[model samples]
Target: MSGLDIDRAAATQMAQKYRNAAEDLESALGGLPASVDGGIASGVLADIVSTLAQNAADLAVLSRVMGGVIDATVSDATATDDSVSESFGGLTLPGEEAAP
Candidate 1:
């Protein structure tokens, strides 16, 4: 399917998967102890936690954006321009022609 196509079921499923993974990371990070061993080990743990937190945030944003992508676009039949498909990496949905 085209990226811009409204595959609601697949989108919902993917969003749910992303959310679950983000939530799992969040829980793991939250449950981590305040400190590891000493010096380098502590720094390493801090870095790992930071990275995980960032990934979780990114995934959450992606999940929301996936759903929002469907909401933010005009239906192909009603759209007056090729701008939408062009915006999505130039991938036109089935039955849409690239503007001349």
Candidate 2:
């Protein structure tokens, strides 16, 4: 069976990057209005802006979700490693003396 071998440091860093991107997108896109007033071709501009904003919002949400998943996966992997290590700590290897 294939085993999981997650690099916690790298995974955590990637998760942080995703979180930062989400924050950046939300901050930048949240200022846009669905419709701007008193400008030529404002209707067309508004429609474009509206679509961009929706897509940005969706992407930001997905980024946040991905970050959360990575964080959770790292946490679970670490827990499993610790558990396995603890379980193995009591065992004596071949040709090795047991602890007194």
Candidate 3:
């Protein structure tokens, strides 16, 4: 009934969606042939590779969005905490950190 409760619920749902998308990407990647045979047409192989690449890109974007939502929810929950401070030592805009 409160804003925090709603944010928590939404964060949970976003996490679940991200998990499902990751699983689907894994399954699709696993289903692809390890190597294409000489008999197979190059165009077919190219198409498969293209599709896989697109799926990977889509998953990456979904992950970014989900991460943003989770971070926003956490920030909202922690807004009143006195000990917490916002800092970006290594994290980039895309949710990854630069290697030290």
Largest TM-score belongs to which candidate? Answer: 2
lDDT of 2 by residue, 5-76 (tens): 898999999999999999999999968765688488888888888888999999999999999999999999
lDDT of 3 by residue, 1-100 (tens): 3443445666777776776676677667667765666465876887788787777868866776786677676666767443333454445667666757
Tell me how candidate 2 scores on lDDT: 0.91
Each candidate: RMSD? 10.3, 2.0, 14.9
lDDT of each: 0.62, 0.91, 0.67
Clashes of each: 0, 0, 0
The 10 consecutive residues of candidate 2 with the worst lDDT sum are 30-39
The candidate that achieves the highest lDDT relative to the unseen native structure: 2
Residue 86 error for model 2, in Å? Answer: 0.9
| Candidate 3 backbone collisions, by pair | none
Candidate 3, run of 10 with poorest lDDT:
80-89
